[model samples]
Target: MVRKLVSVAITCCFVGSVVAEADIKNLLEMDLDEILKVNVATGTSNAISEAPSIVSVITQEDIKAMGATTLAEAVEQIPGLHVSNSVNRLTSLFGIRGIRNNNTPNVLVLIDGVNIAEITALSVPYAFRYPVNFIKRIELIRGPGSAVYGADAFSGVINIITQSPSDLAGTSAGVNVGSFEYSEAWINSQFSVDDLSVALSITRQRKGNDSERVTQYGVLQRDGEFDNIHVNATYHELTFNGWYWRSEQEMGSGAGIIGNDIDRDISETISAQLRWVTDIDKFTRFETDASYTNHKLDGLFQLFPEGTWPVGDDGNLFLPPLLL
Candidate 1:
């Protein structure tokens, strides 16, 4: 049997109103065959009539229609791709072509060509923490991209293109509320002056529960409060992106959930990236990117009392308590 691969391509022209209008008009006037022949740029630097690998496109319109609030929800619309809850439920796992892993380190994710996978954990943070409101479109490649993207593109690659100044046209803001005491608000704006163009977006979200429960030692486990902030800005050929996420939740029964407010686990992630791009010639280009990411976990598991000590093999009490 032959296995089938699928890729996604986003087809919205976000340069400016004039170009967008013209492209829309042209698309409307094109026949089915012409539309099918449209080129995509995800597989290579140059656009090709057809993607070298199986490809699919998800446009902003589709995302809006589906009312997807997160990147994982938006990606679930594509065929052969499924999103699952991580062990902690605070993160997400991506499954493609029946392949699944704990951390999903095989998939590569890019934002405007900058890689956002956490270096230490080797996981795509965008899968769980990314907001979809500021995205212009997404291009998904459903086959191996290691040849072009190097390692971590073991299974596939996802390239997320954010809204540009021309795409925004003006300032906009929105608020969202949902079950489980979830709420989110965001603002986005764009403008251009002379040769310089600027686009900015910021979002904040808060939630009470992550929506999954675990059972350990015959006790029920529940997640806790979560907060996240994301910011993206672009000026001319330079771009900056940053995200901060924090979770304050009970450490679960396995960690000896001492009390509702006593045993706690706090996880925090901070990431930032600055990128610049320029054209050296008609057929050549240069790009540079700098990034910093940190993931910290601090908490008191409290498997035993603070004063309790552990006995060593020498049958003597150790100096320090065996704090989990």
Candidate 2:
């Protein structure tokens, strides 16, 4: 079964590429033959004619046309996928095919073939954390991908490919503001020097309130701030990628989990990768890659005090004070 699945995935690559060039309007007009020629690379490197599973590709053009600002928003456009909130409302969740979890650990997310899922937590790292500015395209494969991508690819896989120097050609900057005291600014630049291509992007965002109305504990005013930096460079078959992201969010009562508690949650992620690829023969290829990733969490939550209290039949024994 695995071999057959692999063979089918190989065939879909070629077909995916053909359909990629067609606009949404033209796509409906294309004949079945043209539709079968659409090419995709998420399943395998080979361009097979048949696909073993469902795959959805969102190009950069589609992103711009939809005015999507974050990766989560872009993904929400895909069928059978929805953006959900974690129990504590601290993380964004990707719920696919009605399957939901606290961390959305059933899904696998990657950037240019590099895994970005948090190692210890085994979940999507900082959901909606990635800005769409540098993304050239996104390929999402729904269903089990363990045969090709190993464990944690249980429900789906999302592959994000960043733009190259040729894609940007110059520099750009933008800022936006919205309700709830939301504001963001970003700058990106791409250029070529000699044989090397480089692209860099930086973004910062702040939101004074999450817009969630507290019914019982009153309004705690959940707030969040984020900063991200991305860099990519390629020289011939050798490529390098770097990403750094930090976020701080004020946890507002945690959806009544800890009632009226005021605390903060902070997280940071750093990742870098170096890869070299070479063609060995007409039908053979060789590639090597090295990557490093780190995720850190500094959180404060209010819980019951450490000391214990005596229990009495009256149920009014001395109660310990809340601890931070």
Candidate 3:
């Protein structure tokens, strides 16, 4: 697969007449052992481990090197993990260590110490999903953490910490435009007033693709748009700190040639939390956190008879004669 990726990358550059950016020295200087040596679980109240349990941390620097735009893309590089991008933009199935269970939520995902797993279904939804630009670090701890954190932490725990006031103390903003007329813009700024710290951010993204032919049985839709606005507040101290965030997204779909229907989905999330940490003694400390998130989804579809419309939307039709 690596060879195939390399070949594709080479062919892309050759056909497009574009220059690729890479650090040959950094590639040669990379050490697998050293890269995996970083400790992560110690910072939290979770159980301790004698030996690393297939753990790894992808730093912001590492995320930049990969030039990936999605969390799934960044996580696919982890050993023993497979990320499957399904038809639904709000669905992603991941497997780890040969545990390929489709109907179970074996993997747990936490953002800023809060569990973001979907409760209505068994897996995580990609609609209100977190983005990479807002990420600070991704910590993966393989094996079961259910005993310490609770259910859904079976396969492992993926903790993604978004950029905080401390991480983005200065000012940073950029715009990117590329193929398919795809475009994106983002801003990360911080402010300080006395002991209180605050940060604000906004992002927008859109793209159009016509790579796949539309069909009734197959995935007839292949385009999407996303926009998000975020804010962070913090009261920095040795004993306590707190923060909160909210975002919204919309995904568009194209109808097959048979029908003139347009399907689109809209979703939003509002999350808030409070956390307090206090030291009981020299070597021990107690921590507590509470949070809540409200998420919703709305989709519009079409209705047609059997075989009448090769590619028709899913609209319930009952008591047709009376209702019509």
RMSD of each: 9.5, 8.5, 14.3
- Name the better of 1 and 2 by TM-score: 2
- In the range 1-324, model 1's lDDT, one tens digit per residue, is 111122222221212112235676556556543223322334334222445776666778889999999888998888988888665433677777777787778778877665666544466542245778788777777767777777787777787767766667788899999886678888887777776666777776665543444353334444455555555667778867766666666544543333334666566666667777776565555666677666566565555454444567997645433332
Query: How many residue pairs clash in model 2?
Result: 12
Scanning candidate 3 in windows of ten residues, the lowest lDDT window is 1-10
Candidates' lDDT values, in order? Answer: 0.63, 0.70, 0.57
Best by lDDT: 2
Candidate 3 segments exceeding 4 Å error: 1-52, 101-104, 213-219, 236-262, 280-284, 305-324
User: Mind giving the per-residue lDDT tens digits that candidate 2 earns over 9-104?
Assistant: 111111212325547745554564322332333344432234566877788889999998889889999999988766454577887898878788
Error of 3 at 147 (Å): 2.0
Q: Considering lDDT, which of the candidate structures 1 and 2 is the better prediction for this target?
A: 2
**Each model's total of backbone clashes:** 7, 12, 1
Estimate TM-scores for all models. Answer: 0.68, 0.77, 0.70
Model 3 agreement with the true structure over 1-324: per-residue lDDT tens digits = 000000000101111122325676345435643334333353332222333456777877888899877677788889888876444543566778866465338888767655655554355544533457877778887777676567787887787767767768677888877776577888788888898777777777765654464334444344566666666667753212222323233232322222434445554445555665555565555555556655555544443435533332565333324323
> Model 1 scores what on Cα lDDT?
0.63
Is candidate 2 or 3 superior in lDDT?
Answer: 2
Error of 1 at 172 (Å): 1.5
